[model samples]
Target: MTDEELAISVSGLRKSYRDNQAVAGVDLAVRRGEVFALLGPNGAGKTTTVEILEGFRQRDGGDVSVLGVDPAKAGADWRKRIGIVLQGTGEFDELKVGEVVRHFARFYPNASDPAEVIERVGLSDKANSRTHTLSGGQKRRLDVALGIVNRPELLFLDEPTTGFDPAARREFWDLIRQLSHQGTTILLTTHYLDEAEALADRVGVINRGAMVAVSTPAELGGRHQATARVGWREDGQARFEQTDHPTDAVRRLSERFGGEVPELTVTRPTLEDIYLEMLGEKEEQQ
Candidate 1:
């Protein structure tokens, strides 16, 4: 598929289970070779939306397309071109790390080498170790290796780095970067705002089973030109003011200090701050 074609498309998507409406009138579009993030609180219908896109669940109403075909009608060839790393853990208690990877590799007609995939996820040293013996982070890496073993055109990562430590998280980000560089479209869902900022080309924020906004990380919540807080120590107490022109504020503070402002800091809204504000706004509207 060319870059212009949408890897995922949905319009007025809706899903309901019994009396509960899980997803409601959602619209989304994801471009090829882009890392798109879907973020929302628990029970916000994020899982249901993903499951529908993955063809694991049927939507109650609305149009949906994945790779130019309706997910519900897409066949095995369509399934082979997509990879999914679910939130649930894999069961390979009796198999060695390499053994499990190799086992899965055989299922795909064009799979990545098991050894290479293991190395890519930083599990070369644990290739011979039993899968059950690996740490939480290591096991997550194994899951990732299995997901990408087919070298799919599109990948769905659901809370991919849930149990990772700081170091492991960074390593996992590198792997994601590598996949993106290879022109693999990715759809990621995670609660980590920083992760979304670091990886997603575009992010869509969902709340109460509806998409609230969609934009690049910098543009989300009006963060690109949002007011910045400028602060400095004055009379042994810290004072701060929010302003759109932080440079001018700093210049004025510099004059007040005759040179340098004491403990001066110009802080812009971080991804987390902006995300929280967006969520708050959504709540108020509801």
Candidate 2:
């Protein structure tokens, strides 16, 4: 896609602290209206790159654009076009949920209604509760309510569901999908491979300050092309064969058995499997 169509664009992105390079010659592009997930282990420069994109930190070198404006040079008007939910829960313990949402709604000229935003994030019932009384997952919902209350064209989520239970995490994923369906471009950073698989249109992996790969969850690290494992019970033993075409292998196995292959199962490398392999290789090269 063209630069105009990208919500974020970075080329030769670099940053350093004293003698250590936290980010090194990284390149990335996130398309408008698409959910993009950035994956990396701790200290892999994911935070640094995202901070530069959010204009919260300055990069030592590289060209960066977010929402068609250079974030490093952005002003208040530019800021209104994007929203961010940081790793920490931005809370006012003394305020009610509705009151807090209303306060933040005033920051943007085109902000959505406080009540509606709260409801959209599934917080309507807790609107009158004190911030300090909410659960961990509720705090996260409140954070998202504030983030999208501005009706931002782009939203940044940093470990959005870190402390959420499984069910709450799934609910948050649905909310993310609703936002994307309404034309919001989302940039998400998460350690959960399943989260990326469920929410991202495309996922990018960064290792040791460089982008290792970028593709759909199923295709990352050539996962789609990777060999498949076909397993079955044979002659009182469990046996399996690794091949590119599992169907062909299964067909031969069935023919050999002259009937249904016993306990047949076909498996391919999962997203986590491919992700770990990428990180392992990157570490070895260093």
Candidate 3:
């Protein structure tokens, strides 16, 4: 995409703490209105890379640009254009939900209505509730409310759904979709592979401070091109085989059985499968 079409761009990003090389020669680019997911295991430098992009931490070397300005040189105005929802809850336990949201809105030049943003995050019922009284999931919703109160052009979400139940997670997924639909650029970092699969337009995987792969959920780790596993039960025994053409295999099995193949299943590799395979390969290399 063109320069005007990009929200974030980085080249050869490097960072270190003493002898610990957290990020090494990383390159990343995010479009103006896309939900990009960064997936990696613990200590894979994902947090370091994101912190550098968010201007919270400085890098050791290489170029970095966010919203057309170097994050290292970004000022208050630059910050107003970006939103951040960290992995932990905000320290506003003494304040009511609405109070917290309204307080943050004052920091931005053109902030959204605190009440509207609170309702947008499904927190209207808790508007008068103290921040400390909220359940874990409710606190997370408050975090999201604060993140979008500025109506930012770009949002950074680091494990935003960590404390949610399955139903709450699904609801948060819908909220994320709504934001992406409204032309907000989102950079997400999450440990849940399924969350990335459900929400991201594109995903980049990092390992040991290096980028391993970047692709759509369906095609990552060559998953789309990988062989399908066909399985069936025959004569009181279970059997399965990997084949390029699952349909052909199933058809032949149907004919052999002279009818529907009993307990037949044709399945492709799942995202978790592909992810583990990639990690295993990386470990072998080390």
For model 2, how does the per-residue alpha-carbon lDDT over 1-286 read when each residue is reduced to its tens digit?
8887999999999999999999999999999999999999999999999999999999999999998899989999988989899887887898999999999998899999999999999999999999999999999999999889999999999999998899999999999999999999999999999999999999999988999899999899999899999999978999989999898998898899898999999999999999998999888888
Q: Candidate 1 on 1-286: residue-level lDDT in tens?
A: 4425899989999999999999999999999999999988899889999999999998999999998889999899998899999986786997999999999999899999899999999999999999999998899989989999999999999999987899989988999999999999999999999999999999999888899899999899889989999999999999999999999999999998999899999999998898888889888987
Model 2 TM-score, all chains together: 0.96
TM-score of each: 0.97, 0.96, 0.98
Reference-based lDDT, residue 211, model 3: 84
Ranked candidates (TM-score, high to low): 3, 1, 2
Q: Where does candidate 2 clash, by residue pair? A: none
Q: For model 1, what is the C-alpha lDDT against the true structure?
A: 0.92
Q: For this target, which candidate reaches the highest TM-score against the unseen true structure?
A: 3
Query: Against the unseen true structure, what C-alpha lDDT does each candidate score?
Result: 0.92, 0.94, 0.93
As a whole number from 0 to 100, the lDDT of residue 109 in candidate 1 is 98
Per-candidate Cα RMSD to the true structure, in Å, reads: 1.5, 1.3, 1.0
- The ten-residue window of minimal lDDT in model 1 covers 1-10
Winner by TM-score between candidate 3 and candidate 1 = 3
Clash list (residue pairs), candidate 1: none
